[model samples]
Target: MSNWSIDAGVICFSGVLDRFTVPDLWASLSSWKPTEKGYLVDLSRVERVDSAGMVMLIHLLEHAKTENCHIMLSFVPKDLGTLFRLSNVDKLLAKHIQN
Candidate 1:
């Protein structure tokens, strides 16, 4: 199971972002508007992900960029960091790098 929460400039998520998790992603994305500042998604709680989850994040990034907003990922696990590196999004998201 997976869940998420969002407030003006931040979006926090914990759980899987796989095929079954797309709905959560959509719900989060659709909540944003062009006028919004941006997003900082906390993926530290998410234990796992599949391609669908990656796609969801990519789409959110596209939306954020097109809207002239920034999207960040916080506390990414090591395994997922590798995935982000392979996907060429290492610097784009987890620029915060607190952990």
Candidate 2:
């Protein structure tokens, strides 16, 4: 199972980020709007992620960008980072790096 929490302008994710969970994350993010401080998605607690998960993450970032919302990813796990690199999506991911 997977879950997320929204607090202090940050979205914290936990558990596996697979096909099943990606959609749920998408649904949750639909209601998110960036504040002046922007938004951050904390991935420190994310246990795993699949290709679909990665795609969904990209989609979320694209959605945010189109809306002119300032959002980023934080504490990205090594595995996900590698996936991003291998998939040649690291460039897009870089635009949303927390630090």
Candidate 3:
């Protein structure tokens, strides 16, 4: 049901997070100012995550921390979740990339 949608603090990424990904996420994330404790990461669209993509997200995470904002990813696709887990990146990843 959720393919692409956004609110003030939520980005419903509902397709794929591979290759030319994360930039869109960056745009959406930069669309507004951080005015609260947390935001959201709708990875429902993110189907695959490569190293480059992960790097971008990690940068976002670091920036978020310095800014004192947060992102919570919900409903990540099954395969990507496995990929994330397999890469052992789940530990270093911030809280937003989880359900």
Candidate 4:
């Protein structure tokens, strides 16, 4: 199962990220209004991810870009990092990645 929360303007995600959980997450984030200088997406607690989850992240990145919102990805897991690198999205998401 996957869960998400917005705390102090940061979007926090926990649990496995798979096809079943991607849509709801997308919906929730799509409706978000940025009150801070930038938006932060925290994925450290996310235990797993499938292809669908990766696609969802890419789409979310595009959405944020179109909205002119600066969104950063923080605490990304090693596995996800490898996936992104292999898919060639790491460079595109480079500026947004935070260790």
Candidate 5:
């Protein structure tokens, strides 16, 4: 199972982020509106991630764009970073990722 919390304009995620978990998380966040112009997404505690998780991250970025907000992802897992590079999507998300 996976879960997320927001504090001080940062969204922190923990546990596994896969196909099963992404659906519920996505549903919950779909209607969320950001109150800040800039936000940070901290994934350092996330144990694992799959393609679905990557897709969800992209969707979150798009959602933020629609709201005229910007979200930077921080502490991305090594494996997920590899997946992004292998999938050739690293460039697309590079500007939004913070090492």
Candidate 6:
């Protein structure tokens, strides 16, 4: 299972973020709205991620766009970054990635 929390305006995620966990995480974030200055998504504690997790992150970015907000991803895992590159979405998500 995966878990996420918003603390100090940052969304922190932990545990595996695979197909099984993305759904619940997505549902839990339905009501989330980024602040005017945007939001930071911290994934440092996330142990694993798969395609589904990538899709969910993309969807979250899309959702933020609709609200005229920006979402920045931070502390991305190496595997997840590799997946993004392999999926050819690195460019699309590049602006949102933060070191």
Best by TM-score: 5
The ten-residue window of minimal lDDT in model 3 covers 1-10
Overlapping backbone residue pairs in candidate 1 total: 0
For each candidate in the order shown, give its overall lDDT on alpha carbons. 0.74, 0.82, 0.64, 0.83, 0.95, 0.90
Q: What TM-score would you give candidate 5 relative to the actual structure?
A: 0.97
How many collisions per candidate? 0, 0, 4, 0, 0, 0
RMSD (Å) per prediction:
2.8, 1.8, 3.7, 1.5, 0.6, 1.1
lDDT score for candidate 3 against the true structure: 0.64
User: Candidate 6, residues 1-99: lDDT per residue as tens digits?
Assistant: 899988776889999999999888999777787766688999999999999999899998899898898889999999999999999999999999998
User: What residue runs in model 4 are displaced by over 4 Å at the alpha carbon?
Assistant: none
Candidate number with the higher TM-score (3 or 5): 5
User: Please, what are the lDDT tens digits per residue for candidate 2 over residues 1-99?
Assistant: 788887887878899999988887878776766553567889999999988778877877777777777778999888888889999989867879866
Clashing pairs in 1: none
lDDT tens digits by residue: candidate 1, 1-99: 888877766778788878897876688676677556667778879888876787787787777778888776777667767777888877776553446
Q: Could you give me the TM-score of model 2 versus the true structure? A: 0.85
| Model 3: per-residue Cα lDDT over 1-99, one tens digit each | 113565777766555555576666666655545676787766656656666555656666677777888877677666656666878887766456665
lDDT score for residue 10 of model 3: 79
Clashes of 3: 4
Indicate which candidate wins on lDDT.
5
Candidate 1 Cα misplacement greater than 4 A, ranges: 88-99
Ranking by lDDT: 5, 6, 4, 2, 1, 3
Which parts of model 6 are misplaced by more than 4 Å? none
Residue 95 error, candidate 6, Å: 0.5
Per-residue lDDT, model 6, residue 72, is: 97
> Which is the better candidate, 1 or 2, if ranked by lDDT?
2
lDDT of 5 by residue, 1-99 (tens): 999999999999999999999999999889889999989999999999999999999999999999999999999999899989989999999999997
Off by over 4 Å in 2: 35-37
Q: Please list all clashing residue pairs in model 3, or write none if there are none.
A: 13-45, 14-45, 15-45, 73-96
